[model samples]
Target chain A: MSETTIGGIAGRMPKFIRRADPAVVTAFACIVLLLFLGSLYSRSFLSPEYLLQQLKVASFLGVIATGMMLVILLGQIDLSVPWSVAVGAMMAAAAAAYGPVGAALAIPFGICCGIMIGIVNGIGVAYLRIPSMIVTLATNAVAQGLMVVYTGGFSPQDSATGAMRYLATGFAIPGVPNAVIIWAVIGAAMVFVLTRTGFGRSVYGIGNRERAAYLSGIDTRRVVMIAFAVSGGLSAFGGVLLAGYASKAAQSMGDAYLLPSIAAVVLGGTSILGGRGSYLGTVAGVILITLLQSILSVMQMPEAGRQIIYGVVIVAMLLLYGRAPASR
Target chain B: MKDWRYWLAEQRGTLLALAIFIVMFAIYTANHPAGFTANVVQTASNKGVLLAFVAMAQTLVVITAGIDLSVGMIFTLTNCLASWLVIGTGLETAFGVVAVLGTGLLCGAINGAIVIYGRLQPIVATIATGAVYFGIALLLRPFPGGSVNEDLADALTGRLFGVVPASLVALFAVVLIVWVPFSRSVLGRAAYAAGSSETAAYMSGVPIRRGKFAAYALAGLLAAIGGLFLTFFTYTGDAAYASGNAYTLFSIAAVVLGGVSLFGGKGSAIGAIFGALAFRTIGDLLFVFDFDPLWQPLFQGVILLIAVSLGAFALFRVRNRLEWFL
Candidate 1:
């Protein structure tokens, strides 16, 4: 409580803050700036409704990025995001078309579909030793093809029953959005799993140094597989929410999400290379990216100009945070 | 025989894939005998020429422990530039060709500079540049439309001599050019050495940076060639056409299938050419099979996974056995 003690604390605080991951700080700064800009541009941006709406949009991307973060944390990339989303949506929507029984089928079908893709990605990365980027890229292509072939580019619509519809429109507390709840729950669960679980430690361990991790007797392959499966499942979950939101799945609906998901992950102080990152950082990143896009939309920028800005913003963020000295 | 075995070991992945392609071709011919006729093969070869060039471009960068995702976008830029230039210029047809080629080389140089000098990773760097290149192309002609001389397209598509198409001739020329320098030049050897291990190469005075820069520049040049062929084949330039889509992935597949290690080093241009051919043949076969267009991407994904898996498994097995023997 003394003046000298307070000064000492304050001075040390700046150094501690400076040492904080740049991505986390940037994410925080960006969120504040975006909110400020959004309020200036549109009064509605400050409103609870607008914030909830933004959170709703962020939920889809945030969840997927959480999964993607795991894969990227493992020093691999997955380009199959769009296709994976499409496949998940199509399978779920198609399954749900048959009624509540079908609707119930959608969740497992989507998760299972993702799990399978994750397995392929794991085997490709671990056993086969193919680059995750190329393997995932190819898998994405295959998924796209399957989506088109199976659905003929036309998803059979499932009736959005009250519960399904509640996913997007309903909120836990009045004006507090169901999406926000779902996102918080998922984020909390992931944080626990990432921090407390053996698998989570293995993920960090393997990502940091696979050889060392293996030498330490961790089941590296299994961890990677589980990570990818979780990623695939989360992506599927996003697809399902999207389906519920729209009450229908459309072909290529996942396309817009691919870049945003990666952008979110990158923005979340997690190194793109495996070994060092956190779900908390990912949560911050998701909020930051969502806010950026929402603010841009509120600004009424043209689609092309928005894309140009999107690319610029992402590159800038990467340059600032990407130099973590831990990259391979 | 030992030397032959070593050579075979060096190129086995590509050769195996090529052998599979031949068998696939035979089956296709059996199913559609007319499809394998000389003119058909020539047409397929011609169609594959751009891919072959792009694959070569991809291989160059890959050999340097890098990748060029911007090749397709650069190709778009060149194609658009060709259209823009050819339309306004009073120059001879030869001059037009030179200008197009120049455009591509310049694009490559820019990419090379960014990647090598800027010290950016090839994947992320090319991705950003790919966007810039595509944006430039779109800025040139916003619409999915442009004009190219029909006569030029005809010449590009037509046979050079009675025996071979102009496209085929051009592709062969590329192969010859890439192969000679890659196989014989000290620079090429150094490039490969750098790719295999940058630190070791640097330690041994391999001019690793120079080799990387040159490899990237070569990749850009090859991409430009792909653009030229694309212009001729399509007879038009669309800003959105094949920008950041299948062409980049296709080129990688062709390179990988041809036995070029995705990890960098250990592949041949000859193998890349064949890989291109095989990819095209399979694409054609897919169409012939009446597979839904939706399934195409999935099938390609499966094929790529399978190919990469096989190659990776083989590589691991070989390394393990080598260690055991040693």
Candidate 2:
């Protein structure tokens, strides 16, 4: 190429980059790369059935990530996911043991437990002015302690109800998993809410600049509280599903989901700083993380290695996309 | 009158933290079957000092408006490294100590480089590096069997002059050597400036990048010191994941209790030290009170929430409402 042409292309590169959503692009690219790597590790990794199973697994993370994304988008966070999930699963399982009414109310009761936690989280952040990080973390400890006391510090005695098991492990249509279907319904609802509603606009506004949103009559506090509540409920729902899959609730069962949920949300290109992101990006992120996880496990990499990779991916992505303009 | 009031306001957080520690320690000693003796004090100091060091490490980063989730991992890594190196002859042990501490400095430097130069967020960057540090720790002590020099370990952890705890003395010396100089230094002031308002700091020509980098790097060094102490106390290294995570979380709690603001640019390491002591006392209180082990987490959480909520009372005076977001 001519010198002038090369210079022109270089000069235009920043502009073109600015127009593309880095989170969505990076997530999709990672997914493709992970898929290729997975196939290389095991031929069956490329099969439709294997991929579908991965999607089913991703669905749980997806459900939780959806909630996390809502909070992150509001420039706040919910660290209560671990215990919230535990509460949901434990409550659902415990309620399931009582008979027909208990079984029927299991899911709602589980979700209600989560919403309650979320509301408390919301009150702390919105009204008391406590940093969400501290409040949620404190609440998480409280939940853990409460659960331990409730269970007498042993494994919970209750097992998942038949319906709970069906929701988690059962197939709905010929080949599709029920978990995937649930995730899709949630995802679709979220996409619609984020794209078409005043609440969505309010969330984006509040995330971008809370004071500005409030000045513009957004009722920012209410939006934040509701966002947290939704996050809590969804996280608990994810926990309930996990309990269903595992057939019982165990102490510290929700402990594993906290970091991965944040990872998935950020991986999908949702800005950890909030105010800008799409659920589509989050979906891509969830799939990519799941695939990366599968590939790593297939290689017999240890848990420590998996955690390191997970952390690295998050840092790497932030480096790639989170940087502000150099000229500034 | 005005000057003294201003001074009081400036020192309020530290004073509050100190008051909390004093009250908690007093209650703890009063309830103890053994009462307040050197043996009891030594044991408590040994436990409290480890967290105090870690909290001090956390304090530096928090002052710059950043958090180091990796401090705990760095503590674990150094512990593991110390177990392997802090052994043999006097000169050899000395060199081993330097090596372990140096590794910690390097870990902190990496975090600083990524956050300051690479422009990544502190929370995410540290989380990633923390994982890497834990991974190395796991590799070093997969089965948790390694030893430190017995002479060095006992000397550090044991009582000094049969009265005061050696660990407390060591902790004070560290505060004198590391924190005092850093807090007075230009870079330290720069860190405060940056945390308070980075844009203003930048506009005023403060070396915000250097200040933040120093805070992060020093944080790693402090965490490493905690690790060395861990090795001394335990005489072995175990790559305990839960323990590491717990330390990270508790450090934040300690910082808050110490009067360090999460929003940054405030508070003293001394306060955080006392906060660490006070928090450790909460657990001891549970033990002495004969509470069920199961109630410990719940009580700790409740106490932390209450302690932190005390800091939030000032928000009620905020009139603009916009300041709430800040």
Candidate 3:
């Protein structure tokens, strides 16, 4: 409430605020550039309908990236995301295959599976002293293997329930997709949690230096576990939305979203090293990736070209701002 | 306290990997319908050596405390290139092999340049390059219908001396030619020093950059060898994205199982090769046991989880909370 409390480190605060500005700004600029590029290929690229379609797609990544941002905030990563997304969707759909009760709890059931995965990942990374990348990578494999066994090496037969469909595709505030609303709500919550909550500050602290945070009595492991859990939950939630949009869960549905989410996060100026990033930048990043993808597809780029461009974009953005301060 | 104790401690990981491989092979052979036959062993070795090479590549990068997510992509790319180039008469096939390996070297050098000079994180940098390599692979083999020279493929994939699988022999030869010399070299020591503590290595004026660059480039070269072998086995090159991703993940798993610390500055390619063999045997065990083929993935996953969990036991010995970071 007091200006001194906030502005006491007046010199430091501006740099902190400004540090978040350029990445988001650059992302927005890229979005505009992409829009111009897209329109050159198609006249309707700038249409409200077309843009809304792109927004709906980006919401899926936005939701997933929200969780990614959290773990990344702690300077950790969740490589389990791809299969976690599939597990969430398939389990939710499988649950809905039961009766009314199952249908009603399908979404929650799916998210719970993701949370369980996160807890395991957190245990491995936070308690076991395993690196997060390896831990998450192993968990991803485990999740995939489990999913395969559950599906009998075949695609799941269940379809997304009506509620799932409505939540993902139906218009909530007329003309606005429900998925966009969902992403916005999730984004708002993410921003509030990051800027206004102690847990958020602790995440930044631990990412910056875990020992310092632990010594400060912040219960760093609990924070890390919670972050990974949230990431899992969010990824599964994204999968659920994806299943709804597609009307069913398919094997490996989450594979395509993994790199784009990471690219979006890093493009938004969040340090892959963790400890430094903002939610707004991630939002901008999600949109940028979505547009880039849409435009690439609209241009009828082959799979090879798409992959090349995608890689080039990520490396270029990373090279631009993601460099370490030359610790050597 | 004794010389033997020091040797034992130093070779602990490699020995463990060897133990694991022997045990798994025993189980596999015991359950196998044909028993412990040369054919089965040869088949297993052929399959295992592909992963062994990739694991060796991963070991090199990880030793420098970096990771090359692109290794699998390089493997795929080189496989595809070999499919196109490693064909025709003996002279042409030789040229193609050289070309495929060269492309792999170039790819690894690019990765090293970006990571070292560009000052980017190895993980993210490799992920980006991996995408590019896979794209190139896709472009080369849009369809899985390129040919490799049959003579070379047969000679490489088949048994030698009436019993020894050539693939396994090649793997052993590579260890002698590549890993042995590298391990004894100044650059390799620098890599270890860098991985253990980059700041300390830097302060000590270690050639961290060159060491790391060599590691990355060599990793690429090893993955390329794996690619060439893949072409030999499959007789074609298919840039299956899923397969590429799987190899990348499995190489990490193999590296860990080999007792190579993912944290870096520890372990050996010999351990990783044994780890790969053990991992491959885990899959084959299911076949021998007459389990449904679908159960293979689950079995592999569980084994990997258990193998990785073995490393966690060390954490319990940390007396000081601060030492957890170390």
In model 2, pairs of residues that clash are none
Clashes by residue pair, model 1: A73-A274, A141-B297, A141-B298, A142-B297, A142-B298, A145-B294
Q: Is the docking of candidate 2 incorrect, acceptable, medium or high quality?
A: medium
True-contact fraction in model 3 equals 0.64
Candidate 1, A207-307: lDDT as tens digits: 77787787788877778777877888888778777777887777878877877787787778676667777676788888888887777776787555566
lDDT digits (tens) for residues B175-209 of candidate 3: 99988999889999998988899999999998999
1 or 3, which is superior by lDDT?
3
Error of 1 at B149 (Å): 1.7
Angstrom error of the Cα, residue A220, model 3: value is 1.0
> What digit string (tens of lDDT, one per residue) describes model 1 on residues B58-144?
888888778888888877777777666665344665687788777777777777776666555566667766766776777676765
Measured with C-alpha atoms, the lDDT of residue A286 in candidate 1 is 86
The top-ranked prediction according to TM-score is 3
In the predicted model 3, the residue pairs found to clash are none
Q: Please write out the lDDT profile of model 3 over residues A187-289, one tens digit for every residue.
A: 9999889878999889988888899899999999899999999999999999999999999999999999888888889899888888878888899999999
Best by DockQ: 3
Error of 2 at A302 (Å): 1.6
> How displaced is residue A292 in candidate 3, in Å?
0.7
Query: CA lDDT of A280 in candidate 3?
Result: 85
